[model samples]
Target: MTELALLVQGLLDGSIYALIAVGLTLVYGLLRILHVAHAALFTLGGYVGVVVTNETGSFILALVAAMIVAGIAGMIIYRLVYQPILHLPPYVALIASIGLFIAMQEGFRFYDEQGVSYVNPPVQGTLELAGQTLQLAKIVTFFVAIILIGGLGLLAAKTRTGVAWRATVTMPAMAESFGINIIQVRYINFFIGSALAAVAGVMVSLTTNLVEPTSGDVWSYKALAIIVLGGLGSMRGTLIACFALGVLEAFATTTCVPLGNIQICLGEIMNRDAIAFAFLVIVLMIRPQGLFVRA
Candidate 1:
C-alpha cells in the first residue's frame, strides 16, 4: 500500500508539472519569449478560477471563464510587450518576461497574502486502486492533465494554426514568405499557451486545496526543467520527462536515507521536484539533448 501510494502521488504531481511544461514550451517554441510571466499567469489562473468557482458555484464554468480571461491577459502581454521585441536581441525579450513575472507577483501580493482562496473538494470520496486509496480529486487531476495534453496534441496535428505555429517555430521568415500571417499565428500560440497555463493553475489549486500568489513561482521552474530535460520543442518528450520525474520523485522519498550524517533538513526539501533537478543535471551532463533526441 505504501508503494502504491507513492506511485499515485508521484504521477499526480508530475502530471501537474507536465501541464505547465506544455504551456511553457508552446510559448517558447512559438514566440521565443522565454516567458517569465508564466508563473504569474499560472497563479492568476488559480486565484481567478477560485473566485469564479466560489461565486458561480459551477466548476465547469469557472474553468471556462478563467481560461478565457487569462488568454486575454496573455494577448495583452504579447501585443504590448513581446511583439515589439522582435527586432531586438533575444535577451531583451527575456528580460522583459522576467520583469513581467516580478510585476505579476507583486501585483498579486498587493491583493491577498492569504491569497486566492480555494473551495473544499467537491468530490471528497476515495477510491481504492492498485491496492491504494486515493482522493477522487487527485485522480481527476491526473486524467485532466492527460486530457489537456491530448487536446493540445490534436490541435497541433489537426488545426491550421497548429501547422502555422509549427512553421513559425521552425522558420518564421520562411513561414512569412509562404503567407502564413506570422503575427496572427503568434497571437494564436500566445492565447492557447496561456489558456493551458491557466488550466494547469486550476488543476493545481484543485489538487492542493489552496491557492497562493507565490505558488506559480515554484511551478514555473519545474516546467523549465521539463523543457530542458525533455529536448526543446519536443512535446512527446516533455510528457515522457514529466512522468519519469514523477516516478523518480516518488521513489526517492520512499527510499529512506540514514539521517545521522545528513547535514540538511530532509523535510525541508523532500518533494520530487528537487530530486528531479538533480537527475536533470546528471542527465544533461551525460546526453545534453535529453534522452529522446533524434539523429
Candidate 2:
C-alpha cells in the first residue's frame, strides 16, 4: 500500500506536467513560433489568479478569470507584436520572443513588496484511497486534466474551429484558400494556448501555495521539453511525450541506486526534472521531425 501510495503521487505530478506541456505544444503547433515570452505569460496568470482569489475568495472564478485575461494578453501580443514579424526569419522571431521574455522578467520587480515572505496556501487535505493516502489537489488536478484533454480532443476532432486550426497546421496557404480567417484563427489559437498555460500555472500554485514571477520560467521550460518530445502538432503525441517525461522525472526523484557501494544521486542524472529537456535535445538531434510526428 505504501508503494501504491507513492505511485499515485508520481502519476499526479506527471499529470500536472502533462497539462503544462499540452499548452506549450499548442502554441508551437498553431503559431509556429517558439514563444519565449510564454514563461512570463504563465507567471502572470498565476499572479492574477492569486490576487482575484484573495479578494473574492472564489477559486473557480479566479481560475477562469486568469485564463481569460492571459488569453486576451496573448491575443494582443500576437496582433500587436508578433504579427509584424510573421514574415521574418524564424530566428528573428525567436530573438523577439527572447526580448519579450526578458522584459517581462524584469517587469516583475514592480510587484515586489518589502519584506513580504511568500506563504503557501494551506489546502493540504489528504484522502484515503484503497488504504493509501493521497493529496486531494493532485487527484482533482489529474481528473480535471483528463477531462480537459478529452474535451480538447473532441473539439479538435469534431468542431469546425478545430478542423480549421488543424488545416492551418497542415498548410497555411491552403487553409486560407478555404476562406478561413488566418489571423483570427491565429488569435484564437494563441488565446486558447495561453489560457491553458494559465490554467496549468494555477494548478501549480495549488501545489506550492506560493506565487513568484520566476515560477513561470521553470514551468515554461518543462512545457517546452514536453512539446518537443511529443512531436509538434500532434496532441496525442504531445500527451504521450508528457507522460514519458513525467515518468522519467518521477523515477529520478523517488529512487537512488548504488554504484560500487556509493549512493549516487539519481537527481544528478536529472536535477529538478530537467533530464527530460536533455532527452529532447538528443531526440531532436537524432530525429528533427520528432519521434512521434503525426504521419
Candidate 3:
C-alpha cells in the first residue's frame, strides 16, 4: 500500500514535469534555441494565475488568463530578443536566453514586492482508490497534462501548421520555398510552448500550495535535463523521461539499500534534486544520443 501510494504520487508529479518539459522540447526542436528563460515564463504564469484567481475568485479564469499572457509574452520575447539572433550560432542565442531568464526572474521579484505566495484552487479533496489516497488537485493536474499533451501531439501530427512546423525545423529554406511562413510558425511554436509551461506552473502551485519567484529556477534545469534525457527534440522521449525520473525519484526516496556494513539511502546519497542528473549521466553513458534519439 505504501509502495502503491508512492507510485501514484510519482505519476502525478511526473505529469507536471511532462507538461513543463514538453514545452521546452518544442521550443528547442522548432527554434533551435536553448530557451533558458522558459521556466521563468512558467513561474510568471503561476504568479499571473495567483493574481487573477485572487481578484476574480475563479480558478478556470485564472488558468486561461495565465496561459494567454504567457503565450503572448513568449511571442514578444522572441520578437524582441530571439528573432534577431535566430540565424546566429546556437551558443549566442543560448547566452541571450540566460540573460532573458535572469531579467524575468528579477522582474518577478520586483513586481511582487513581498514575493508571491500560493493560492489554492477552488477544488480541494482527495480520492481513495483500493486503500490508497490521491489528491484531487493532482488528479486534475494529471488529466490536464494528458489532455494537453495529447492535443498538442495531435496538433503537431495532423494540423497544417504542424506539418509546416516539422518542415521548418528540418529544412527551413525548403519549408519557406513551399510557402510556409517560418516566422509565423516560430511564433506559434513559442506561444504553444509557453502556454504549456503556464498550465504546468498553475498545476504546481495548486498541488504544492506555494509560488515563490524562484520556483522556476530549479525546474528550468530539471526540464532542460528531462528533454536531454528524453532526447532533445523528441516529444515522446520527454514524456517518458518525465515519468521515468519521477518514479525513480520516488523509489529512491522510499527504498533503502545496504552497502557493505552500512545501509545507504539513495535519496540521501544522491539527493532528490540530483537524481535527475544522475539518471541523465547514466543514460548518457549508455546512450549518448538519449533514450529515444537515433544516431
TM-score of each: 0.89, 0.89, 0.94
Best by the TM-score measure: 3
State the number of backbone clashes in model 3: 0
Q: After superposition, how far is residue 259 of candidate 1 from its true place, in Å?
A: 13
- Per-residue lDDT tens digits of candidate 3, residues 1-295? 6878888888988998998898888888877788899989899888888888888888899999999999999999889998998778899999999988988888887887555554545657889976888889889999999999999889879999889988888888999999999999989988999999999888778866667778888777988988999879887888899998888888887688888999988877777888778888988999998899821
Question: Candidate 3: deviation at residue 265, Å?
Answer: 0.9
User: Can you rank all candidates by TM-score, best first?
Assistant: 3, 1, 2
Which segments of model 1 are wrong by more than 4 Å?
257-271
lDDT of 2 at 274: 61
Clashing pairs in 2: 120-209
Better of 1 and 3 by lDDT: 3
For candidate 2, which ten residues in a row score worst on lDDT?
Answer: 113-122
lDDT of 1 by residue, 1-295 (tens): 5777787778987888887888777777776667878778888888888888888888788888768988889889999988888789999998998898888888988888777665554445788887777778777878888887888888877998778878888899999999999888877777877887888888778767678878887788878888778886677788888888877777775676566787554335656566777888999999998876522
